[model samples]
Target chain A: DTAVSQTPKYLVTQMGNDKSIKCEQNLGHDTMYWYKQDSKKFLKIMFSYNNKELIINETVPNRFSPKSPDKAHLNLHINSLELGDSAVYFCASSLKTDTQYFGPGTRLTVL
Target chain B: AQSVTQPDIHITVSEGASLELRCNYSYGATPYLFWYVQSPGQGLQLLLKYFSGDTLVQGIKGFEAEFKRSQSSFNLRKPSVHWSDAAEYFCAVVMTTDSWGKLQFGAGTQVVVTP
Candidate 1:
């Protein structure tokens, strides 16, 4: 069984379009996070939620927003997507201060 | 500010050869250290972690890492490498002071195994 899972394993959309990625974890974790991996493979944290509460928000553009409906789910929405937004988005979950489990990742491609 | 560094951007090893991946961190106190492996088109898998008590820790797939406080390093090692061992290796750390499990990751090292 999958521990953490993300929808739309691959997405391709034109620039200026809007898209969203959904994440869910079955590990009974209290915290969840979103990380972006660029084409160069450098990964950076975007947002983190603890028990459905926003805890960490990096210096990402306002066009990017994270919504946590519950402790088990965290979704990312992007508005007016740009070509530079093309990258792999990863979802992770963990207990507070504990090891994290990552999803397979959603590859986003903006044309 | 705390940061992690992976000196080698890429490494190539022959099957059955020994392998070593270097990692260093900059932090006032010893932070929680971890090593993760990301295969092609795959998610990250935790190889091992060192919270405390021991400087050397063993991980799955016959991998091991040694934490050296003096050197500010935690280098991963494997005695024999197999073709399946090739993957992107990342060194990450969680600052003990951080309440949330925010991980500071290094620029990963890409390992390529050849026969």
Candidate 2:
């Protein structure tokens, strides 16, 4: 489809386990972003990649790393996930710094 | 630092009634403003955006927002609301020259519409 897509709509894992979420955008955009939405519905930016290069990193823990193999895809890997890591992660993409289109989001739960 | 504030955490409005959601922003310079609506279990959809133009901007679904530079506010309003309008509304802002222009969102307001 012509939209931002994310793998595993819902995720449940142990607190110490490692997990990865993949995101892809077919909008032919040059920039992609990752945002975290807490239980209170407060959305915050975590990272952003432009043309497969890191552009913005919001002081997220080193345990959280983002990899963009190509401009169309950006994947997030979390190491030693903690209870606080549980939240809905959304992937978005924009063209020429225009409107950002968001994916359905991946809900991560650390049990 | 740039920030967005949505004072009303929740609002209940009767169908066919006028609706307004408050949003305030704090930025060092002229910032880009946006209003997004998220339906139940769905990603956010842009209702409107204000970059640079007239102070009053018209958006989709009979929505309109007025940018008050003096007050540093961009408030969303609708003459009449529908039942399907019950959802969460978020106010966001981005720096004009920010790299990637990461959007900073407010805490969001849960809007409920009743018949």
Candidate 3:
């Protein structure tokens, strides 16, 4: 069984289109996060949720939103997807400790 | 603000040779540090982490990292290299807040192992 899994490993959408990526973790972790890896391979944290509460919201554009319905799932929704948003989106979960388990990233390609 | 720096953008090593990847961080207090590896087309995997206690921590896949408080560095080292070990490695630091775990990552370093 996959500890952390993301659906639609690859997403290709046109500009101005809205898309959502789903992430689920079975490790019973209390915290989940969304990270974006740009073309330069720089990973940046966009959002972090602990037990369905928004904990950290980095300097990300308002177009990117993260929703955690529960402790086990965290989904990312992107509105008005632009060319600059073409990158790999990774979902990760961790307990109170700093060890994070990452899901297989979803490579998003916005045309 | 907490930040991580991986000075070596790329490193190449011969098979069976020793390897080392340097990671430096800037933070007000002692911060939690981590090292992760990402294979081609795969997500990042935690190699090891340093919270407190011993400075040296061992991880899976024959990887180990040493945390140096004096230098504010956490460097990963391996005794020997395998071709399968060629991948992108990242160093990260946790934000110094009481909130849940949130990580700030470095740019990452690409490792190329040659036979």
Give the alpha-carbon lDDT of every model: 0.97, 0.93, 0.93
Residues A1-111 of candidate 2: C-alpha lDDT, one tens digit per residue: 649999989999999999999999998999999999998888999999999889999989999999999999999999999999999999999985788889999999999
Cα lDDT of candidate 2 equals: 0.93
Displacement of the residue A42 alpha carbon in candidate 2, Å:
0.5
Candidates' DockQ values?
A: 0.85, 0.77, 0.81
Cα shift from native, residue B54, model 3 (Å): 1.0
Off by over 4 Å in 2: none
Rank candidates by lDDT, best first. 1, 2, 3
Per TM-score, the best of the predicted structures is 1
RMSD of each: 0.7, 1.1, 1.1
Off by over 4 Å in 1: none
| Tens digit of per-residue lDDT, candidate 3, span A1-111 | 999999889999999999999999999999898999999999988999988999889999999989999999999999999999999999999986558899999999998
Task: Point out the worst 10-residue segment of candidate 1 chain B by lDDT.
Answer: B95-104
CAPRI band for model 2: medium
- The i-RMS of candidate 1 is 0.6
lDDT of 2 by residue, B1-115 (tens): 5679999999999999999999999888878899999998888889999999899999999999999999999999999999999999999998898756889899999999999
What is the DockQ ranking, best to worst?
1, 3, 2
Q: Worst 10-residue stretch by lDDT in candidate 1 chain A?
A: A37-46
